[model samples]
Target: MRITTKKLVLCALMTAIVFLITFTPFLQIPSPMTQGYYNIGDAAIMIAAILLGRKVGFIAGGIGSLLADVVTGYYIYAPATLIVKGIEGYIIGAIANKKNGVPSRLRQAVAVTAGGLEMVLGYFIYQATVIRMINPTLGMASIIADIPGNLIQGAISAVLALVFLTVLYRTNTVKNLLR
Candidate 1:
């Protein structure tokens, strides 16, 4: 695919935004369930998906989240973060842009909900199986305990994303530039 200067620039900006948002110290709730902590980086991921299309969202979300994981010294999670965030971004963008125009409120809600669930499920699956394999002592019970934290993280991110998106939608400036 030929890259347009516009797309290149937007992708770069969005990627930077995602990285900054993910890297910055956000409200983190410590989970007793596992080594993982819940963060609101998903809010930024949702915003990127809403502003950009699927391809750009996937690239920005994946690389940005992967970099965040590396920078945060969570290197073990970088690979999973890449795939999970990429899929999350793609799902949001695909649902939001379903009509090839302005996304409806319902679509936006669906996108956020699905994307949030994707993140929660993706990490859950990774931690439950893959991490369990790395450490045979890890039990399914311990992994299952993380569900509540993940659910809380997902819910908060969705609310944050919805609020941000709503404000952006109201201001035609950003919306116009996105188009």
Candidate 2:
């Protein structure tokens, strides 16, 4: 089926929200340095993937993350961030959207798993194969460091998705497309 106008509108809004929250953080933690701060942008990535599917997810994830990086004084990491976020969004979106009648619960679990795995996989690939300057230990160390945060973000995002998607479904704004 052709991509519908409604999907485009929602995707645009979600992408905007991703950009907004990447900076504001409906939830955030503090640290002495930049590395210590955490944001829900990744959850936005997961949401885009799940709701809009891979293509839209990729676009939203890349642009949203790149914008966040630029705005947050993280321009150095912007390029890599965009690619990794795009991949994370696409993979999760692809998994969450299935042709078969998979239940929403199962798809949500899958999205969570995929979200965490993306952090693990992207870190390893970028560190080991593509670039090492950012973090020489990016190969495995990045994954190790990211696990707890990623899990927390992933679970939170899943819960949020359930709530938001349910609301949309009820309003007939979006299908229980998640289901």
Each prediction's number of clashing residue pairs:
0, 0
lDDT accuracy of residue 114 in candidate 1: 94
Clashing pairs in 2: none
- lDDT (Cα, tens digit) per residue for candidate 2, span 1-179: 77777777777887787788777754655422224345667777776777677877787888887888788786755787788778878887788885654338677667757765775466445545554565465445544565566557656765776666566646744544432
- For model 2, the stretches where C-alpha displacement exceeds 4 angstroms are 1-8, 30-36, 98-103, 124-143, 175-179
The pairs that clash in candidate 1 are none
- lDDT for every model? 0.83, 0.67
- Candidate 1 structure lDDT: 0.83
For model 2, what is the alpha-carbon lDDT of residue 43?
74
lDDT of 1 by residue, 39-148 (tens): 87788888888877788779888999888878877787789999999999999988888446667888889999998899889988999878888878878898888887
